[model samples]
Target: MLYLSQFIKMLLIVVIMLQWINPAQAADLTVSLSDNQGNPLPNIVVTLTSPATIIEEAEFSPQHPAIMDQIDRQFVPHILVVPKGSYVAFPNSDSIQHHVYSFSKAKPFELKLYSGRPPQPLEFGQAGEVAMGCNIHDWMLGYVYVVDTPYYGKTNARGQLTLTVPPDDYQLILWSPLLDSKDSAVQYSVDVAADSKIDLSLKHALLPAFEGFEQSDEFDDY
Candidate 1:
């Protein structure tokens, strides 16, 4: 009985130690973005993709729809990042109606004039940037970046994003609508083990924000 009790205690200790050394513990990856002028660039989408991350698994799994809201004639987020095959709802919170549409090749669709949430969300089946604008309010511009990987985030006001992911080798990708079409996506090879940080600077100055559509009397009737 004494030997059995000792064996049980040893087993308990081993179990506790094993739990402390769990390989599933998530690691933090900090990504910092800056423009060529060394100023923090916010609203940039960052994604991490690895061989272990199955795109099909993420596509099949149901995810809560993301919202691209309009308030005061502008897209609240300006840039939204979502996993490929996810749905995005355009909710108009402003008093005025908004007609949101995207001409980008990734996803091309339009939400006719509406004042509230649409009945259904639109799915972004492809992995690319969707540049959106309001047909009625030409100045209103926004973007949706759809990525194949499930691990993604957007930079905050300070141009910093932290992602918790399993330790593995991954390809880090960054995207922004302001970037030129040819250089929109920047990729880097990263191996994440323990907590790590990466700093990236844009090669060129970002394009100026869309001010407004060319003034024309064609729409003077509203």
Candidate 2:
């Protein structure tokens, strides 16, 4: 009888240990974005940065090159989020030539008229927004958001993004090309001790939507 009692005590201790360790594992942060009308807003860039998570330039490692393809005279993704110091390839899949350039202060360079992929990918060394445009196609516009942290992603069709991050206090930032100049981004202080969800709405109405390639008169010319 004593032996069985001791075995039960050991099992209880082990179970208690597991319950304590489970909370230390990474947790998910579900963020849902909406516009003024409460309609789900997609393509919004979301980033979570902790004050303790300071990244050094020497520790920055570039992941697989990101692709910003030109298809049917429009940027495949209207907005892209990339980590700082990462490379982005501008591949022109269309038959016609494309000159992709960004005047944004983050990374400014011009890819003169070209049909195929550029010889090399351009590196985004700064952390800011890079607005791209095609010299030949005036209405064509796109944005590349460069962030310093890896905990970043764009909202999907459902206007929701899930990020797995260690338990910490983070500053959640949201940005979109459609955001008004006066209110470019929305930010909040989030304390994530476990799986958490946040619902955010834009303070101001978004700017008019960009003209798609199909909607432009230039579509028939090419």
Candidate 3:
């Protein structure tokens, strides 16, 4: 009887120890973004950064370079998300030539007159939004969001994004090409505990709509 009692005590101690060793499980984070009119906003980039997370730096020459193809006189995939210190290839798929350039401080360079892929892809060394435009095609606009953290995603047509992340604290940043300025960008401090879902709305209206490439005298200066 005493031996059985000792065995039962040992089992209880083991269970308690196991509970302490394994704590809570990580969770998935979902973010929903919409414009002021309560309509879903697409192509909005949602970025999360945390001090506890470690982001491996991408070398100047990345094995898989992000491709931004130029087609139908417009930048395909209008928004591109790239890791910091990575390379991006601007491939001109259309028969017409393309001259891509960006004034963004993250990485500013001019790709002068290219028919196919450039000799070397452009490198993004910093973490910020890079606005791209073709010197020849003024209406051809695109954006590249360089993120230092791994927990980042762009919202879809439904303005929703989900990321599996460790349960911790983070700083969330929401950016859109249509934003009037950086001052209007949405930023929030949030804590990710168990599976979390957050709904966000933009403060300002998006830029005026210019769906397709229209002949405008303003484009002459570009």
Which candidate leads the pack in lDDT?
2
Clashes of each: 0, 0, 0
Residue pairs in clash, model 2: none
RMSD of 3: 4.2
Across 44-156, the per-residue lDDT of candidate 2 in tens digits comes to 88899997765455123335578788887788787878888878877788878888888899999898747754647778889999999988887778888899888888888
Over 4 Å off in model 3, which ranges? 1-25, 57-61, 180-184, 214-222
Query: Candidate 2 — what's its lDDT?
Result: 0.81
Candidate 1: C-alpha lDDT: 0.80
Candidate 2 residue-wise lDDT at 183: 54
lDDT of 1 by residue, 78-152 (tens): 788878888887768876777888889999998875665454778888998898888887677788888988898
Candidates arranged by TM-score, highest first: 2, 3, 1
Higher-ranked by lDDT: 1 or 3: 1
Runs of candidate 1 with Cα error greater than 4 angstroms are 1-23, 55-64, 181-183, 210-222
For model 3, how does the per-residue alpha-carbon lDDT over 28-132 read when each residue is reduced to its tens digit?
899998887889988778888888766676643545678888777777778888778788877777776778889999889888656754557778888888988
